[model samples]
Target: MHIAEGFLPPAHAIAWGVASAPFVVHGVRSLTREVREHPESTLLLGASGAFTFVLSALKLPSVTGSCSHPTGTGLGAILFRPPIMAVLGTITLLFQALLLAHGGLTTLGANVFSMAIVGPWAGYGVYRLLRRWDVPLMVTVFFGAFVADLSTYCVTSVQLALAFPDPGSGFLGALGKFGSIFAVTQIPLAVSEGLLTVIVMRLLVQSSRGELTRLGVLLTKSATAAAKSGAVAR
Candidate 1:
């Protein structure tokens, strides 16, 4: 969900900008390494972003608006890297706002922080954590997409609350309002995203030529790929 300008007070914008700064820096660094290490994957990276842009912008009927869309957080994190995904998303949102006006220009940073930066990072983090616990691939994907969507909505809701503190929309209330408005649409979409992410991840992991190539975990070609394959098998 793109937060329009005036959706949040100026203070909210500043606060989010400050919070997003570190992620931007870290993302840039991570992307640089990814490009350096896997030059062959840059095309794949761009394609991943295109997939996200299309999925996110496709008009899915929703109570709020058909504008409601799914982010490719899980897909990106599963295949590439989360930081790279953030940058890809930032580009997608920027262009979408400029050409389609799906979101506001002035609020680009704010929107980026909520949807591109925050959502993907949270999804990636949770996915990694669950992986450590031997969680199933399908379950991990579902949870990642679910968390990413909710996190974006939470940020959007909080921004709205900041704008109209008296909308009487506390965090939970805002969450309820936003969730209710989109739940019927989001629930099914999330399941779809999760399935898509899992299938893609499974495909990539299985087809990887080297051990380290598995799971995009950046390990030595043999050991890492073997480790990843073993994990996936479990």
Candidate 2:
């Protein structure tokens, strides 16, 4: 969920901005180096950005009046590097705020910290670790997405707690109430995202085997291909 502008107090925004600065810097530097050294990096990065925007537009209803959209970060990270995905996520969020009115400018940094920087890195980390395991790619993707989605909500909860410290609501209380709400919606949303990511991965492995190899998901490519082929025949 996009935190509206002015929803976060100025102090909270500034503080979180300060805290998240180093991670942002690291991501930018890492991406810049990749783009400069490898010519294809820039193009792939741009493509990921486009895909991120398109995926965000495809929303699934989570509750009566609200919806949750797939992040697309997991697929991006699987294809490219996590640092660039961070940049892509931030750029996507900015475009949504400016052109699509999905989020606000004042709260852009806060949203970036939570959804962009945190989600991609968290999911990518899990994927890297679990890629060696015996579990299915879909299952790994689901857990990676599950953690990423929940992490976004966790950071959002912290931001809200800091920005809107009700006279009676303590830190743990804020986490419980607000965090629980995101949990209810994001759990299913995460599962859906994982399933979509797995399907995409399977298709890519079958249609563009070389590309998946270049991206270093070759083992996963084989696994997903076999899994999909089996499912199709069944």
Candidate 3:
């Protein structure tokens, strides 16, 4: 979700920037180490960033001068981890703001927190939790994408509510209003993105099982092979 420029108060904007700085720094270090250890993943990283860029760029207007779109953080977070997703996501946001003008530079920090840091962490957490529960791989992937997309909008609603509270209802009321607006569009988009992510994950498992395995996208080589074998059978 893109928060338009000059929408946030100076204090709020600067505060978000300050809060997001450490995450970006940490993400850079984490991504650097991951690349060093697995040079082959560089292409995968680029692909993930591209996916994010394309999906997030399709913004639809929503309440409080914000917009709704798929965060597309789930696949990357599931494959590369949240820290690396944060770095990649920031880069995607930067390009979208600068080149596409879909988002703005002044509000980059707020956008990063919602779309990059929080969304990835939420999706990755849900994925890991569901996997621990022994859920099916496709189900896990679907929920990861769905939850991540919704979580990004949820965080964006909060940011808007905090920035522009309702006169009579205050932050809670404003949050509910903004959230309802986003939910109307974001829910279907989240579901669509979840399905798309499952398809992409299956394709990766089929054509690039080795890469998914190396990234630990599939927990075991045997599982990856089994998935491929099943696809072949189908």
Best by TM-score: 3
Ranking by lDDT: 3, 2, 1
In the range 1-234, model 2's lDDT, one tens digit per residue, is 678877777877677667666766877897888778776656656766776776667787775346777677777766776776777788888888899878788788898888887877788888777875556666776667666666776777777766666567677777676776665667667777777777766776677676656667675657678867877798
Query: Lowest summed lDDT over 10 consecutive residues: which window, candidate 1?
Result: 209-218
lDDT of 3 by residue, 1-234 (tens): 678877888888888889888999999999899889989889998888888877787665544455567878899999999998999889988988888776678889999999899999999999999986769999999999999899988988999999999999999999999888775568878887899899888988898888986777776858767866877798
The global C-alpha lDDT for each of the candidates, from Candidate 1 onward, is: 0.69, 0.73, 0.86
- Candidate 2 stretches greater than 4 Å from native: 41-43, 63-65, 219-234
Predicted structure 3, TM vs. truth: 0.89
- Residue pairs in collision within model 3: none
Q: State candidate 2's TM-score.
A: 0.82
User: What would the TM-scores of all predictions be?
Assistant: 0.79, 0.82, 0.89
Clashes of each: 5, 0, 0
Cα RMSD (Å) between model 3 and the true structure?
5.4
Stretches of model 3 off by over 4 angstroms after superposition: 59-67, 221-234
Ranking by TM-score: 3, 2, 1
